[model samples]
Target: VSRGQAGKPPGGPVPSCPPSGTKLFTSTVHCTAVLEGFERLRQDGLLCDVSLLPGDGEESFPVHRAMMASSSDYFKAMFTGGMKEQDLTQIKLHGVSGMGLRQIIDFVYTAKLSLSMESLHETLEAASFLQVLPVLDFCTEFLISETTLENCVEVGRIANTYHLAAVDRFVDGFILRNFGALSQTAGFLRLPAERLERALASDSLKRCTELQLFRATCRWLRHSGSRMRQAARLMSRIRFPLMSPQELLHEVQTKTFPRFSPGCHNLAFWRASNYQMLPPMQPVLQSERTRIRSDATHLLALGGVLRQQLLVSKELRLYDERTRLWRCLAPMEAPRYQHGIAVVGNFLFVVGGQSNYDTKGKTAVDTVFRYDPRYNRWAQVAPLNEKRTFFHLSALNGRLYAVGGRNAAGELATVECYDPSSNEWTYVARMAEPHYGHAGTVYGNLMYISGGITHDTFQKELLCYDPESDRWTQRAPMSTVRGLHCMCTVRDRLYVIGGNHFRGASDYADVLSCEFYSPAADNWTSAAPMLRGQSDVGVAVFQ
Candidate 1:
């Protein structure tokens, strides 16, 4: 009788001897002698008696029987036709074991398979059914290399369903590469009209307008098709011409349609076509006249008034136009440069500006400051997380908004707001682009920002910010790009003044250009030029 290795017996006792008349070898005998003696006893017709010794029970049958049964079932399910009810249609299988059926059955039973590019497609399908995302991703990557325009749509749909952003991007790039083959396909360009409108409304339109599709659309409008009539009506409602007279004439000569009536050549076409030639005169005549009256009164009121004053830096001179003009009424408690200043009741607030560095290369003050004009005193308030300089500031409701500005690192797209009651600074939203040395003015609830530097270059982008929604929307662009500009509102109209083109190597060559922005029409029209090409000038309007 053989003994098992050292361990407790399963299910209670270990068996120590063979059944009746068995030959038992002592531990001192050699292993070969014990095996031969047992064989001889079995051959000699001597029956062996095996029984478990008390306190030496260390063998059991159920555990070994269960292990052998499990392995047998696994083999049957894998190699034999035992797993008949298991579905393999959705189950992905990979690798060639010289037998497809054998490989599939092996994978179904053991959840193991070889990975390869040729079998990736089937594997992906199976993995998706099993909800094995890691295996599915592997298969997707293998399949992505073979993807073409024909299969990209299917690939994109699957990627989108799985929320695989990387795969979706790859599919999009593939489609874009084969755009010509898919251009006329409805699936290629089909999108909701609202989405198309949004894309047109985006800054991407600045580049999209240069594309062949946009130009083709413009050309198509010249023809007398059903779309042409609809387009003409739309243009008329928006006070624009659908096509030039020459373009319309060419279209009429080339194509025939029901909307191409002879009477369509009425005075409206001539009037719309000749609108640009009406005059070279100023378009803001009425607004300018009103502005002149308001300016005269504002200058008269501010000329003699004395107000509290705070000196931010030696180069900057700030004073309240309501009172006390020339006196050092208050000392600025903190450093500020090109900051936005506002006054709510008797409290004056300054927000966000460039600061000087100390000897240890630390910033001095990039914070907001509050000053009591009544007490002629200043105190440091909250600091902005971002530092900005040469930005525009305006007050609306009870909050102060800081517009486009430049930091020591250069121009920034950041816009920040401060609440006096809370004594905290919060970043609201950013502008469409970085603009510095610009002018900002508030009318009603909207803040208008215009004319600043883009890179080292000047730009005339006119943008508006709505603090309630924390969003910036672009209006019409200004006619001229200027920096160090001043903005003032009078009679609901905004007048911009006294800014120069601070480009070129020589500073004295700056040009005098001034413009006005009309909110009602969302347009900029030329006003009287400034008396001089001046930068860093101050302007204020009050009646």
Candidate 2:
């Protein structure tokens, strides 16, 4: 018995609904009342339209609408089993607790959340999958900004793997700044071959020479096609002097025997194997009968020498500008490049430049050929370690400082100081940057490096390297980036003259622009331009 319709016939058993107004009719009426209530609501809704407002606590409605607007495939990939639950758990357990599954869930649900390092790697993967570039960029910037020497190798590896160019550049800068420290632990720095090759091209030889890096260099040399051949040739030239005469004989015998004598029995091996059997010969012989001349005229030519009389020789001629004519005087033993000569006491020391080459095609001589005018002959002094060409060699504090130059490598920052008294070369502080086609002049104790090309890039920055501290510090930027520039000290002021400007591209013909740098203020100001645009020029102060 249940209440129905408007009345339920007191406490009597619920009568069965009837047709018309009977008890059965009342049951049918109750059923009709329920049906009519629902029909009235449907009629009103069909006639009226409902609209949502912002303050109704339904702001999330638009978001939901947007999600529904997206394709089914995208929604499933982002929020479903596509992202592994195990990965999320691992991320939380290992240091990324700050960006755990909650944040990830928020992103999946609302498509937005703040990211941190703990969640950075995960976010990057998610963003890549979701095609969100802003999030990806943020992650890359975070990695680059937080990179350190301790983690540079790991960061660089990741950057390279993902082809993040900007991150790679940042790592390179860090490595360059801490080259010496990193070199000590090069055994741990692991990077790709292309990255290492780019580093090598930029004069990163110090880094490349470390214990582990040297192995990488060897691998690069072995596999590099033409580069390998060139390196082999250069190394062969370097090893020539260390080989003994017996060893040299063996090398020649081995290499030439196949072409010269086919029936040879390992002549190279025999030459190297047996050195005691080699014989020594005496000087050449001349018969007394051949000493006499065939004619009296020829005999007269030797009469002076035969009489043992000292012969007067003609002295060397020199130009007497006051007299406006040439006159006889003591002459230089050889005509040499005025810029290539250095004077110490009574001796004129001549070091090598772009001079004669040995059979191996190495330019500049290691032999420091000395010309003593008093003796009128050239004597060889102790050789330099390597050939230096087109470099600035100056005397500083009684020793010769060979600054920057073009070596087997394009440009070199390798500085070597030569002690005239000891006749020895000792390594000195290297320059802050590798430069060639630049000029160097010593003012007091500081050596200034002006405009120069560093591996094809023009640098307008002026740097000063102090020998006392063995460090280089940036001074002031140059007014213009010019290479092959002439630098001279005029009345205690540094004057830079007629140098070419390279726009890091094509070389501009020499410019007449000139500037002077003041050491006191560490500033450069415009100066009078040179009368002519000169390239490969030299300046000397005469007292």
TM-scores of the candidates in the order shown: 0.40, 0.37
Q: What is the clash count of model 2? A: 3
Top candidate (TM-score): 1
Mark the regions of model 2 whose C-alpha exceeds 4 Å error after superposition: 1-341, 356-362, 371-378
Question: After superposition on all CA atoms, what RMSD does each candidate show versus the true structure?
Answer: 24.9, 28.8
Name the candidate that leads on lDDT: 1
Error of 2 at 262 (Å): 76
Candidate 1 wrong stretches, greater than 4 Å: 1-325, 355-364, 502-508
Model 1 lDDT per residue over 58-149, tens place: 32111111211233453235334555323221222232222333323234334456656466545555454334445555656755776766
lDDT of 2 by residue, 1-543 (tens): 666556656566577865785353346576556435434543444321222122213221112212311322333453454565312311212322223323433443344567665666666554554444555576688888888767787788877766678888988877656655654454333545455544434432332222233333444444535444334322221122122455445543444323333343244334333422321100011122111111111000000011143321212333444465765433333322212334443344555454332211134434455543323445556666666655666666666676666655456778877776566777787886777667877788887878777877767778787878878888888788787777877777787888787544664777688898899999999988878888655666543
TM-score of 1: 0.40
